[model samples]
Target: MKDMSENERVARAMMATGRYFTATELREQLGLTVEKAAATLGAIRRCKRYITQVIGSPRHYKVKVLKVLPSPTWHCGEVAPPELTDRQRQQIHYLSSVVFKPSRGIA
Candidate 1:
C-alpha cells in the first residue's frame, strides 16, 4: 500500500533534519498549501498499515516505517520502480481535485 500524500513525502524528507515538525516548518520547507499539509495528515491518519495504525490522537502521522515488509530485491538485475496503488492514486487525485473533461470543440 502507498503512504500518504506528496506532502507526507516532503515531511519524511524534512524529518531527516531531526527536527520536530511544526505547522510552520511544514509550510516553509515543503512550500505546500496549508490544506495540503492537513490533507496529507488526513491520508496518514487513514492509513491501515501496521506501521501507522497505532499512534496517539493527532498522531504525528510520521512517515516512519516500523515493520518493513520483505520483498524479492534481486530480480536478475531488475530495478522495479515503486508505484502508488490504484486506490491510493485515486485518493490523491481526489485530493488534487483535477478535473477531467472532454475537449470542447466540434468533432
Candidate 2:
C-alpha cells in the first residue's frame, strides 16, 4: 500500500470529523508546526474539491473537508498559469497607470 501524503492525511482527518478544524487543532492532532498546519489547510481550501468551507480571517482560519481527493498526477512539461481575478487585473492596471504616466516636462 502506498503511504498517504501530508495533504491526504490532513484531508482524511478533517473529513472523518465532518466539522471545521482550526490550525491549532490540526497541529496538536498531527504533530505539525503551526505554519505547516496553516499552509496545508490553506492549500486544501484553495483546491475547493476537498474542502467544503473555509471560515474566519486569514490570520485565524478554519477548514471543513468534504472529501479526500486523489493526489494530482505529475507532469514533466510546462503548466499553464492560473487565471487572474478581476481584482488582480484592476490592480495591475492601476499600478501601471501610476508608474507609466507621461511626465509634465519638468527640468
Segments in model 2 whose C-alpha atoms lie over 4 Å from true places: 72-107
TM-score of 2: 0.58
List the global CA lDDT of all models: 0.52, 0.80
TM-score of each: 0.36, 0.58
Q: How far is candidate 2 from the true structure (C-alpha RMSD, Å)?
A: 8.4
Tens digits of per-residue lDDT for model 2, 5-75: 68878898889988898888989988999999988888888874574677888777788888766555445
Residue 38 C-alpha lDDT in model 2: 83
User: Model 2, residue 42: displacement in angstroms?
Assistant: 1.2
Q: Pick the candidate with the highest lDDT.
A: 2
